[model samples]
Target chain A: MSAKIRLYVEHPLGAGQSVPLDRDQAHYLFGVMRQTVGAQLLLFNGEDGEWRAEVAEASKRSGVLICQEQTRPLVLPPDLWLLFAPIKKVRTDFIVEKAAEMGAARILPVQTEFTNSDRIRQDRLQAHAVEAAEQCGGTYVPEVADLQKLSRLLDHWPEERQLMFCDEAEVGSALALASETAAQAPWAIVIGPEGGFSEAERKRLHALPQSHVVSLGPRILRADTAAVAALTVWQQRYGDWG
Target chain B: MSAKIRLYVEHPLGAGQSVPLDRDQAHYLFGVMRQTVGAQLLLFNGEDGEWRAEVAEASKRSGVLICQEQTRPLVLPPDLWLLFAPIKKVRTDFIVEKAAEMGAARILPVQTEFTNSDRIRQDRLQAHAVEAAEQCGGTYVPEVADLQKLSRLLDHWPEERQLMFCDEAEVGSALALASETAAQAPWAIVIGPEGGFSEAERKRLHALPQSHVVSLGPRILRADTAAVAALTVWQQRYGDWG
Candidate 1:
C-alpha cells in the first residue's frame, strides 16, 4: 500500500551521481513529505530512466540525493501533441495534468477568437506537467508551450503531422479514426474553448489537409473532458496505447 | 454565440404544460442567469425528451414555465454501468460527473479492501450527476447508486452483463476490448481506487466468467483518469460512442 515517492529532477541521473535538490524539492522531501536521511525514492530527469535515489542529506531548505540504481528505463510518450484553447483556471490546469498523464508528448495552448483567457502561465503549467508525470509513474514529462494564436500556429503547422480536429459540429462517430494509415507520422489533437471554435477557425481547420474533423460522441463535452476523450481515441487508433 | 440554458425538471413536458420551478431553480434562472418572463430555455425530466420551455412566471424564490415543443427525443445512454471505488471528494465527484456526461447509464460506487474512503455521500453525488447533465446538455442523467461492498455486488453480479475489468496488472492495449462481441448487451467498467485492487480482489475478478481483463494503455493512470480512459475505450468498442 505504500509506493515510493517519485520526484522530477533537472539534473542527470546515474549511478553514484549526487543530485542537488532545490529549495522546494528539499522542502517537499524533508519538511512536507517528512523524509529523512537514508530514505529512498525514485527520481526522473525526463532524460535518464527513473533512478532509485537515497537521501544523502535532508535539510529543511536544501538536500542532496545519491543515485543508487536505475529502476526504470526512460520511456518517451508518443510523438503526439495536445493543442487546446485555455478555459477557466482550474479547468485549464486539469487539461494539462490529464494530457500529461494520458501520454501526450507535448502540449500547446491555442488562442482562438472565442478563447477567454488572454495569456497563460507557462512555467506554472510546465510544473503541473511535471507533477502529473511524477504522480503517474511516467518517466517523460511533456513540455507545455506558450500560448499562441490559432492563425499563427496554423501558418507554421507541420504538414506531416496529422491533426485530429475535435469538431463539436462533426456528425459522424470517431471509429473512422482507427482506419487512418498507422504510419510513424506525428499527430496532434486540437480542442476548442468552452465556446467552441469560431466559424473562420473551423473553416481554416477543415481546409487543412492534415486535419481530420472527428466527433467525440453524441453529447457535447466540456473542454477538459474533450481533451481526455480525444487523447483516448487518438491513442487507441494510432498511438502506442496497445 | 449564446446557447439556451438547460434545466432538469421532474414534471412531464408537453404543449402548454406549466412546469413549476423550486426555490433554487428560480433563483438560478432569475437572479444568477438573469432570465425574465418569456425567456426561452430547454428542460428535460429524464423520462421525456428535451423540450423548449418559456418562462411564464419568474420570481426570486419561485418560477413557472410553459412547454413549447420537444427539441430532442429521449435518447437513453447505452446499458453501461461504471463501478468504481470512490477516492477524494472532488475526484469522486469528477468521476460521477464525467460518467454521466459520457453516457454511462448507471454508476455504482464500490468499496474494496484497498479503497481509502470510508464513506460516500450518495445524495451529493447524485446532485453532481444532475448538475453535470444540466451543464453538458445531456438529456439522460445517469443514476448514482449508493456505495456497496465490492464482494457483495460481485456475488449478485448479472451474468448477462459483461464486465470490462480494468486490471492495472493486465498488459497490452485496450484495443482487444473492441474484439469482444458487439452485441447489444449490458456492460460495466470496473475501476479500482488509487491503491488499486487487492490480490484477492484481482483473482476473483479474473476468475469471474463474465469478466474480461483489459488494460487502459501503456501508462498507469490514477483512478479518475482511469475512469475516463476505461469508459472511452468501452464506448468506442460496445457503447454508443462509435
Candidate 2:
C-alpha cells in the first residue's frame, strides 16, 4: 500500500491532541482505508507543516487522530500561477492535476467568449487539486479559484506578475520570449479555449504591459496540449529548472 | 476551412496528373466532406511531397483528383520513436494523439509485466494517429508498430538509438540529464506501465549501455503525465523548440 498521508485544515497539531476529522476525511480514512484505532497516519496542515498521527478512536462514520510529532516543515511554493480556460470535463480535470503536479502556486479558470463549458464545478475542481497535491507529496495545496470572466481577470491583473500568453497566432518561436521574460519574475501561463482567444481578447492581451505572446510551435495544439506545452516551456524558461 | 489534405500510399505525385481515389477515399472526400467535382484539395505522398489537387470526377464510391502543383517538399521527420506500455483504451488513444502532435517518427507499444491492457486494437490507434497528424498539418505520419513484448524489444534493441528511460524512482532534478543527453544521439522515450517497471525490468534497463535513467521531478506522476513531461523536457533540450 502507498503511504497513509492525510491532510486536515484544522488547528495546530500537537502531541497527544485529539482532532476529529471531518465527515469526508473520516470516510476516506476509516471507511475507505479500513483503519481502526491505533493505526498510524501522516497529517499535514497548510500552516504548521506535516505531522505523524495515530488513530485515537475509530467509528463507521467518524475517526479521531492524535497528533504526535512533525514529519516535515511547511515550505512555500514557487510564485507561479496557472490561468486556463476550462475545456471539457476530463480535460479540465487533467489541467488541474498537471498544474498542481507541476507546482503551480494558484489555479484560476477563466471564461472566454470561445470557451465551451459554461458549468464548471469549482468545488469538484478544488477537490482534484487537493487530491493531486496529496498524491504528489506536497504539503502546500494550490488555491483553486472560481470561474471568472476573462475581461474581469484582465482588469484585476497584477502588475508585477508577468503573463506568458501562449498565442497560436504568433509566427515566431516561443523560446526567445520565454528566456527574455523568465528572469526572476512572478509569472503565470495563460492558455486559451479550444477555439482560442477571441480577436478582441487577443488584442487586449497584446496591449498588456506584462503580457508576452509566445508561440508553442509551428503546429496548432489542442487547448489541453497547449496548457501542458506552455507549462513545460515556462518551467524550462523561468521556473526551478536550474 | 482548414486545409483539406488527403494521404495516399500510391506512386509518386506529379503536376497535372489525374489520379483515381479508391472507394474509401471517395467516401471520405465526397460522401463525408460532400465535395463535388472541381473541388480543390491537397494530396501528399511520402516520397513526392505535398501537392494541390482538384477534383476531376466524382461518383458515389469513386473519385478522381488531378494534381495541380507542389505546395511543399516532403521533409523527413526526426528519427525519434516513442515506446510506451499500453494503458486503458482512452489513454492509449491519447498517447497516440500526443505522440503524433509532438512529432514522433514512430510509436511502439510494448507489453510489460504489469501492463493492464494486453489487447490493443492497432487499427483504432492508427486511425487516431492519422487524425492527429492530419489535424496538426503534418505531412509525415508516425507509424504505430504492433504490440511486442518488452523483452523482445530489448533483445533487438538498436545500439545507435539512445533510450531516455524516464525513471520515476530517481528523485533529483531532470534538467541536467535532458541537456547532457539531448545532443548525444537519436533518442526515444520509454514510459513504463501504470504500476511502473518491475525490479528485474528496472535492472535490465539500468544495465543498458545507451540508456539514461532520468527523473522528472519530486512528484509522483501518472504514466501519461510522465510521458508528456519527459517529451517536453527532451523537446526543450534538443527538439525544434523554435
What TM-score, over all chains together, does every model reach?
0.97, 0.85
Q: Give a tens-digit lDDT track for model 2, residues A89-175.
A: 999998998888777889999999998766689999988988887776677788899998989988999888888888888845555
Question: What tens digits encode model 1's per-residue C-alpha lDDT throughout B129-230?
Answer: 999998888888899999899999999998788888998888573645333353466888999888889999999999998887888777778888888888
Cα shift from native, residue A18, model 2 (Å): 3.4
The i-RMS of every model, in angstroms, reads 1.3, 2.1
What candidate 2 gets wrong by more than 4 Å, as runs, is A1-17, A177-182, B1-72, B175-184
Q: Give the lowest summed-lDDT range of ten residues in model 2 chain B.
A: B1-10
Query: Scored by CA lDDT, what does every candidate get?
Result: 0.88, 0.79
Q: Is the docking of candidate 1 incorrect, acceptable, medium or high quality?
A: medium
TM-score of chain A of 2: 0.89
Off by over 4 Å in 1: A1-3, A175-182, B1-3, B175-182
Q: Looking at candidate 1, what is the lDDT of residue A22?
A: 96
